[model samples]
Target: MVRGEDRHPSLSLHLRARQTAEYRASTAEAERQLRDNDPDARPHRLQHCRGLRESGCNRVLGIINLENFERENAYGESELRLLTTIAASLGTALENARLFDETQHLLKETEQRNAELAIINSVQAALAAELNIQGIYDAVGDKIREIFKNRDMGIRVYDPKTDLIHYAYTYENGKRLSLESEPLGNAGFAAHVLRTRETLVINENMTQAMTKYGSYALPGTQVEKSSVLVPMVAGEQARGIISLSDMEREHAFGDSDVRLLQTLANSMSVALENARLFDETQRLLKETEQRNAELAIINSVQAALAAELNIQGIYDAVGDKIREIFKNRDIGIRVCDPKTGLIHYPYTYENGKRLSLESQPLGQTGFTAHVLRTREALVINENMEQEVAKLGATLVPGSQMERSLIYVPLVAGDQARGLIGLMDMEREHAFSDSDVRLLQTLANSMSVAL
Candidate 1:
């Protein structure tokens, strides 16, 4: 029996007569000529060339050929009827075998498909549980390796703002590989997938695929014989690529393999987007809390200073609030008397100890006079010694050298009436921009209270 255009005989049964050797040789020659499609080959002599068609169908299941009969009309009508009966039975049996084989094939494919679906479900579950990008990479990478049974797999993240591709996760021969970011120019399979937002499967001739796509490979990876690249797309935008490769086998992946990975890649893209949203929400929540806390601090300080009626009482209230706001105990308030060219420090604390000093003349030099004259705030977190010297400011006789400080002027209408200064002696860069803004707000309230 032979099937289709490539007529290679699949089954043969022999029934030998007296001229068996001659008969077999002739049958072999006929089969070869037919297979080769030789136009000049003659039809068999005394052979029943009628095709054995399946019942009620024109489809030829097999052929019954009888060559080199011992005599002309060796057997009569009875013999022909017997041969026809035999051919009918043979055709029926052949058709049954073919159907059985097809049924088995379909069953196997269904089972394989069910297994792949289960694996995809498991991967989706794992990805959904992860709240960070790195966790999503791990889940997708592991599932890709398991499905393809390939040790080399990678998940690349593309940053459109930078036009760079970063290998967030990679494995080579079941071992982890660390990689750096590269420009996502018109090169490499990963870049191609990201640019087009399409899936690529290279089952053979990887060099051809590379040439057709772009002839570039990652710096730290080995050349692969077969590979598949699927873009991780969410909505209309592609975020990255998921890639799997085999170093030793050609045709290692097929259409089904590409489909499975593409499904998994889609799930990964959703998970990554969710993780980004989660992180952004967390950051915004924290900023709101910080702002609320700063407002509360300002309100509390204003209430405390408002309750004091005298300048001395206000200075004491500010000192108490400053201590609560800052870790350092070095703080002071200087009130300027414009008519007398004098500045008085009614409140000064250094290392938790209060100091009493006489009022000094507001001279042409020193940071105190500069702030009073200009009504501008100053912040010094680095090169404190040089900054103080540049401003012609002198340190108190028994105080520690200040490393970080903020000085804000207290202004009323067009004139700055006083100054509030805080210093940290132990650390540089101890104040942030937010801290400066907070102090300026407090200074405004303090100016009103005065």
Candidate 2:
């Protein structure tokens, strides 16, 4: 017999029996006829069948066939009932197995989702405590190490000011190294990831990877096996990149692992942005405080400069005002005579004592002399000896003279009249730009007072 366009022997008999929902008890004569119809096919002398229908849908699953069953005597009614019962039991067993497999698959998927959620929650908690980008990187790196058990990790940040991406953190073999690199001109995998904003996972021998994609190997590190690169993207901008490598070639960073890391990467981008915003807020607050302090000092000095006119009163008021602002005891003001090219230290205050006033030739030599000549402010924190040697000017070494010094030229009506000299005997970088500018303004006010 034939089913559709294909010829079959006993198989067609079995199928037809199932389609009609009837039992087929074929004999030798039927088998002979089937063989004659399809000589190439195998013919069963006895083909006994019963339809096995699913209980849920009442749809026939297939036939439970007894091929080549020898029945010497006539079949009994009890035997046909046994065959029908066996077919029904087989159908139920098949359905149960299908349901069991489906249940197992669903359970595995649920567990996987749960694990991913747990990782995200843990990372988010860690991120909440970070106020800076480095802290965020550290927290994320720690979590990555915990979950992946691989210390070969790196996080980079894109610096728009420099137009370069720099490595913020890199961990390998229990050591944290300070490393910086640029993401320019297809430098390496990190650069590629940043530019493309794509996640790349390669679980292969490092040598092979390098051979295949030589342009992707990072510059500094010697690779042994595998790597995963995930871009930290916030909205449409690619902010940075994270790279994790494994020494073992056959690493377990499968499809699911890549997905989990991508999710974490997204979270990291948001966390980094938040940290940056927080840092910017703190910086703005600090700037506001500094500006307020500067304004207050300027106001006090303006009042003092306005109230006092005599040289002695002006000197005393200027000394008090500078002391109040700089909080430094070693402060002095000199008046420059353009006629004689001389700088006269008319007022010098140090440690609550007044130094005997002295005068020296302003021969375009010392730091103060240079300020007088150029009419510019100078801040020096190192190489004091070089300035001293270059200028060939005489200076009284005070009790609190230090490496760092500031010289602000006092000018009035476009003529350099005098300058103020201050020394930081305690620390370097102590005199900030704001301090210098404030003192310069005060010196100009003093010049007018003079």
Candidate number achieving the greatest TM-score relative to the actual structure: 2
What TM-score does candidate 1 get on C-alpha atoms? Answer: 0.50
What TM-score goes with each of the models? Answer: 0.50, 0.53
Global CA lDDT computed for model 1: 0.72
Q: Which stretches of candidate 2 lie over 4 Å from their true place?
A: 1-40, 45-66, 69-130, 211-220, 309-450
Go through the candidates in order and give each one's C-alpha lDDT: 0.72, 0.67
lDDT of 1 by residue, 1-450 (tens): 322223222233333323333343433464554446644534333434434556776555545654332334444677558777887787677778878999998886785565456545655565467435566567657766776665688888888899988898888766889888988888778777887899988889888878887766677777888888899898898988888878889998878777767776776677666665675686687567556545555555566656644657657766666666665457888899999988888888876778887788889878888888899999899998798789998765556678898889999999999898887778899888767776777688667755
| Worst 10-residue lDDT window, candidate 1 | 2-11
How many residue pairs clash in all the candidates, one count each? 0, 1
RMSD of each: 12.8, 10.3
Candidate 1: Cα lDDT at 319: 67
